[model samples]
Target chain A: MKAQKFWPWLIVTLGAAYFLIPLLATFIFSLRMRRNEYTFDAYVSVFSDPKFYATFGYSLSVGVFTIIVGIFVVVPAVYFVRLRMPWLRPFMEFVTLLPLVIPALVLVYGYVRLYGSSSLIPFTGSILGTDILLTCAYVMLAMPYMYRAVDNGMRTIDIGTLTEAAQIMGASQVQIIGNIILPNILVAILSGAFLTFAIVIGEFTIASLLNRPAFGPYLVGIGTNRAYEPAALAIISFIITWGAMGMINVLGRFAPRTSARTD
Target chain B: MPAFLEVQNLVKSFGTNTVVKGVNFAFAKGEFISLLGPSGCGKTTILRMIAGFERPTSGTIRVDGEDITHLKPNQRQLGMVFQAYALFPNMTVGENIAFGLKVAGMPAEQRRARVDEMLKLIGLLGFDKRYPYEMSGGQQQRVALARAIAPKPRLLLLDEPLSALDAKIRVSLREEIRAIQRDLGITTVFVTHDQEEAMSISDRIVVMNSGNIEQLGAAHDIYNRPATRFVATFVGQLNTLPAGVLAGTPGERAIRPELISLAPRPETDLTLTGTIADLHFLGSVQRLRVDIGGTLVNIDTFNNQTSPLQRGDTVTLHLAQKDLLTLGA
Candidate 1:
């Protein structure tokens, strides 16, 4: 047994070192702003910067809007697809994965071309319009995760029977979707929402090209100029991402067990 | 009296396949009716049409003299308990029961009171805060029934609500369902393939086959005097023997196992000589398979036999002419 465990343990140690070594180095370097002594001055500098709060707050709001748009767009489409047009599932999967297959840079360029100042809709002409465009792009970007999560949730419970039962009980379509469907799949929605939020927060290319003062562009701007504070910001982003993951695990435990109901 | 709910010449077709081929039936107020059939016999399709889930390809469904063929499922004021007990997993038992009432704009306090009353009706009085996933299949099905009926729907449709449960639970829950239906006096339409279930609880059964209703009558009538061969065989165990045995022409005749016995009837003229092929030792009943002239006939007798029967034993089976049913031509 000891000999059998040798290679597996070595591989696990190597993998752990691969991830932890850089993180440890970054933390050590981030604490070195006050030369010859380890200090939290880098963290304090990052906290002190006004750009940090503004860009973070902007990105957070954009992430929230993207989640909202994604839910409103992806959820119903998934519901209808799962219930009525199950044959369209392959097509939906292909469409949702298009964003991942085609890089974010390519997508934003296409968006700029379509919604430029000279275009009929001209979404990039105003700040609000540009923000709307960016949020819409984020929703599309997060579509694959949102759809898969909601669809997986749908698979757990019988939407067809539940919808029929609700309808037979005099619930309208909206009532069934709002009162019956959403609550059952809430964990799935949260999982997708957190993923979308993380993507929006750390995304670099789209926010950069769109000239939005989001956290991604701000982080890159800080990284190119400052070393210690950039490392601190990366650590903060890491925490935020991990925090979102923790929430997912916690919420996932309560994901409406498809338990005794199916029996 | 006119029917409280009427399905007039209902026909449903799915693309190239006709699921319900022009069927018609109706029932009085407070009637417990069952649509009984094998799978793919359009019983469920008919029930769905009545619930407004599946619109009939032709014909009309009217409840209380209202032509509800074109109405949406929600607008029809019908309560349906699905076989899978489609209770909302997110909601607790109380919320599930109060769902319809809430949708109909019932106030919170009133909804709570109503939910309690319904929970009490289903004998789940204090299970208000329990989510469905924490309950058994029977409990979830009861909650589903309560949810379907909380709004005081004009009609109740049960699409094999007990089919998903264990046999013992199915029997007990079915009794509970029948009791609740009687108390509520809601006109109910139940669909199931299990003939025993329909015969035990329903006031009338519509025996369906191949998207058509073969027979419709009271449970006793359907069981005793089936109008068609399909009905005769489907509703209960039927033994088809040569008509010459009954002294009626040259065709076949149908007989129920219960009607045949080892002991003679008061006027036992018809008789057959057969050797016991197999014997089933049921607790209170003994089922014997007797082979008479190369044809095996199943007969049920009370376990109290003067002399116990075994395989290869010669026995004489006696019956009356009235017991032999000459089924439909």
Candidate 2:
């Protein structure tokens, strides 16, 4: 019994060290930007750069757009599939998982090939169109996470009975989805949104290929030219991801308690 | 006048498999009817069709002489309680009860009062602010009932509502539900696989099997004079004997286990010799299995302070001719 308890604690302590040691090293290295001693110069330099704000702002806007579009498209698709077209569930799950199975570079290549200037629907013709395309790509990339989260949420509540109950209470279809279904799955949606945000903020291959000035491209550009500032930016990116996860945890507590075990 | 709720030749088929095949029944105003059957007997399908959740492939459902077969569930104005107590986990008990009233655009004050009235009716007056997860299964089911009836629907539908509760709670809650239904005098259709639950509450019990109603009548009538072999055996415990073995015509005969006895009595018209094969002690009663002429017969007798009967004991079983139910083969 004593050995059983000791093994788990030892494994956990070792795993923590394996992840945190490199992060601690990077943080210490980032502070060595001053000539002789450790200082906050690298952080200050990265924070003061105007390019940082522009790239971060662009990524933030794209993240928001992707979330809104993802929710609008996925929620209704999943809801209808569950309520009316139950036979289409396997097909829907297959489509959502396509993002995970197909590599991001391969997907972007297809987007570029199909939507280039000479194509029938030339989405890359204007900057705004390209941004829209990029947002669509993000939505696609986050498809698996978002769909699984929302679908699991829908399962935790009795969707058919709840919808029927709501309808019996004189709610229209729109009112049922918006008022009853949406609120019940809000925590799940927010968790998906935060995960999508974390993924979009640091994503590189698609944004760089699309020629967008997203945070990923900016991070890569800084890494190529500078040393300590790159480490500082990496630490900052890690903190942002951490913050997004923390937000999900905090929002989860506020969600209505479901007696059904979602796992 | 037309019956309050009339279901005529209702048929529902999914693809090629027919679930409810040409079913028909009707009841007057304020009648409490139970569609009782074993699982997968299409009792719930009939209830759902009546509630407008499933559209019948053929036939019509008329409420107060109005054909409502094609109406949506929302427009049907029927209150339904599910087996799993489908209370909204996100809402308080009060909010759940007031959902329909709020949707109907009732004022805040009236909705609150109605919610309070419903909670009081279900005997959960102080549970308005509690969420479903915080309550016991019985309490959650009562809240679900309160929520269903809060809008004063024209009809109430309960689909095996008490099956999920404990045995003790199921009995008490069913009584409470029946009392509430009577006080409101609302027409209700309850569905259950449990015969006792159906027998104790319904004004009329519709015993169903394989998508057809075997019998429909008062509880005692259905129990005492089952119209079919399915109804006789399904509604209660019975011992089916060969009609010739009991000195009757050549057919099947059904007799209640309780109607037979261990000792010969003056009321008994026929006595059979047998040896006790097994004895089961049920509360207040003892069930004995007797081997008579190479056939096993089940007899239920009252358990008293006298010495209990044991297996391998020689016994004589008594039966009255009137108690032997001759069923059509």
Position B304, candidate 2: lDDT: 68
* lDDT string, candidate 1, B1-329, tens digits: 88899888889999999999999888999999999999999999898888888878999988999999999998998888998887888889998898899889999999999999999999999999999888999898898999888999999999999998999999999999999999999999999999999999999999999999899999999999899889998888989897555454478877899889998879767889899999998979899999988888999998875788889999999988778888885
Prediction 2 global C-alpha lDDT: 0.90
Which residue pairs in candidate 2 have backbone atoms (N, alpha carbon, C) closer than 3 angstroms, thus clashing? none
Model 2 segments more than 4 A misplaced: A1-18, A101-127, A208-211, A254-256, A260-263, B247-251, B261-268, B280-283, B303-318
Candidate No. with top DockQ: 1
TM-score of each: 0.97, 0.91
Q: CA lDDT, every prediction?
A: 0.91, 0.90
